[model samples]
Target: MPTYEMGQWLLVMCHRTQQPSPDYLVAAFPTDEIREAYLSIASERAEQEVRHILRAFVGHSRSLGSFDRLQVLSIEALRKEQGREATKNGWSPRFTEYEIRALNHLSGTSSTPTWEGLTWALDLLPHAPQKAIDVIHAYMYAHAQVLPDLRISGLTDAAELIRTRYILQGSASIETLLELILNLDSRDFEYLVAHLYEVLGYDTEVTPAQKDYGKDVIARKINETVFIECKNWQGHVGVKVISDLAGRVSMEQATRGIVIGTSGFTEGPATATEIASRWPSRISLLDGIELIKLMNQHLGSEWHRRVERIIQSERSRQDRRPK
Candidate 1:
């Protein structure tokens, strides 16, 4: 299914599950990590579906609470009935023939899934019958909070279950990445910032730390040049810092300026940057959260290259320092 449809399907499931008399129950599901990972790359239609449905169906407070439980159940149950006889006589025939066929087809008899294949099973939920959906709901409820135990529960193939687990675990790696970014030293973090600009299609130059003229990175996109001041401080970035960057932009005749702070900017700095918007050389502020969002979006294939560049830059700086 297209990502929008999948996202819409998940939204519908969340809304349906919210009903007091829902046809399916959601016991346990992948935490916020997996959902955020999917949402980061999911289509705008899917994102709007989530926002509109959650606000109209439940409320803003309950938006993030409804994870992709429906998709998870559908995939898990589909895998269990794969390659099995669809006869009405066996196992009390709880599922209809249509459900059986659908599930079996979705759960291909494969050993392991490629990276792209891991999320493929979730595409089965959009058109599944209520009976099949309910069966999955029950099974997942039974296996709730003990997912690793699914390998022994025999609900799904052991290899398939393990693969699913591994995929879900991999989706959660963004948290690790966030932590790593937060803990990076000043110089390494500056290189990362420069690399991020480069990935965003800017021609970037990292200025020397001591005499940077209040700019850490000079990035040019065609005719527009943006002077960037980076701060890896633990405390709030102040208005004076942004003012200095704005002055630098004016001095250098740059088109604009950016203050990228890992700790985030204070209200005063935010207001100052906003006020600078009226001037010829506008200045913008990017807090840690916003920076991370950009990194998550743009660091797809270039992620390893950016990391290597940061490491290499740090090593070069260390090597060049007087011994």
Candidate 2:
């Protein structure tokens, strides 16, 4: 016979719609024997018995929603399933077993996990390995679409800063990092700029996805407040985009303005310089090369290699898919 420890039996309850809800609970049993005993009785009773058990363990005061499905999984089996799902989703720098354990610990009774919890969980792990930051990145990237509200909290900004610093510590060259950044979507690129500013000792905030008012990021360092616009486009950033940033800077009475373009500015650096000179407040233009240089100045040069590998793998996966 096999033995089981506390929290070995994972119970997951979901609403009838198959969507996870707060009313639906996730509870763990102490051992497999206890779980089996309950299941044997549960199989003979009506579904209401499960609700009674839930209310007994938790509290009857809390309202319970109708859950048509219940899943029983061992913690070990759940970890393996999550690992497979993460790999199938092309998550890079996959979460290690320790990281997964930390995540499970942090989730506790909550059905939804927040970015702050993820960051805190990583810190609490034994030995405090730095690769844990990779776990945060992987989870966020994989669940970004499914959990749109995950990034809403300020704590996530701090986590992003920490993750960015770790990435910067890698040996990837500035050129390679630039290429990797260029591959990011527009929203991610904006968030990356905000994180970079945070690493540079500035307090940064990425504007909401909607109603940004021409500014994608706001960075403040001491008395200096900078308004930034990010362009992840392949084509040159034209005068119009630069002009709009300048307008936002002036309107907000900001200390300065910056336009970060993955592609070079239209008509080259000279044109960008002339455009900035026209603005009332100082305006800095950072092309892809200049942006990478700035990033390399603060951290190690090698992290982009890992990111490149992940990107290439994703591309290969896509290529294999039927059109």
Candidate 3:
């Protein structure tokens, strides 16, 4: 997870399960120890693997120039409807500089949300992301030596200074893709995985509809080849599946193998990972939650555009077909 700071707030990027896009949540901690404590607890409990820092900004106070003055000015125009006062638009005189910083963090450097789109921004204040809030409460309860005197009435913004770049443009499309993935047929899921890896510069092959040799997709890059087993079953994947994937890796002489399961792994499979690790072939397992993270990591700028094009083309093709 990457982090950003503006004045007194710390913004962290988080990707929800099955969602390709990231959401930015801001926090304010009084000391570095407290901040790190929060991160340690969050990382330990996070469902997805959180690594790699993409972009960061630190130690900078947000200024009025950081926001779009024009966008702000336009909000007043929308406050009135047909000559009489109607419902107020999102624009409010109560917006503080810290809130603006939060907005900027979420809006991404390339674009900022219009004032009308900030309906949820202010409400998010004084409460970090749901998970962060939970972790902070737990930390305070422990009363660790780092900040034994620290007390948090509520989440404030973090200001010691750190900020990271966040992309906002494709969030909607990515959400659509996540929904599509969750509802897609098992076959469609395999194809989607193949497509994602292909776009990421891999030479990918989807196995035949018949016997798939324990692997649904095979992706190769340079000398390394990855054999992937896709399991869309709703039940937990047991040791049998992992055992089969381990065998397939040896047969294919691949560099690695990954098991992607929608339901997740039972203790049988999870506990078996250590045994597989002893083999020459490395095996990685990802449940539904982790699968989404992998997709988010692999899919880059071209992803949103590609997803839109594919969806539109599919719709057109269906419309043109005979009834």
Top candidate (TM-score): 1
What are the per-residue Cα lDDT tens digits for candidate 1 across 38-80?
A: 4444333243343332223211111101222443456456545
Candidate 1 Cα errors over 4 Å, as ranges: 1-178, 268-281, 301-310, 313-323
What ordering of candidates by lDDT runs from best to worst? Answer: 2, 1, 3
Give the runs in model 3 whose Cα sits over 4 Å from its true position: 1-180, 268-275, 300-323
TM-score of each: 0.43, 0.41, 0.42
What tens-digit string does per-residue lDDT give for candidate 3 at 20-125? 2243322234346645654444323322212111112111222234234443444334323412432344433444433454445445642432221211322321
| Candidate 1 minimal-lDDT segment of 10 residues | 57-66
**Candidate-wise lDDT, in order:** 0.52, 0.54, 0.48
The parts of candidate 2 lying over 4 Å away from their true place are 1-175, 268-272, 305-323
Query: Each candidate: how many clashes?
Result: 0, 7, 21
* C-alpha lDDT of candidate 3 relative to the true structure: 0.48
| Worst lDDT 10-window in candidate 3 | 159-168
The better-scoring model by TM-score among 2 and 3 is: 3
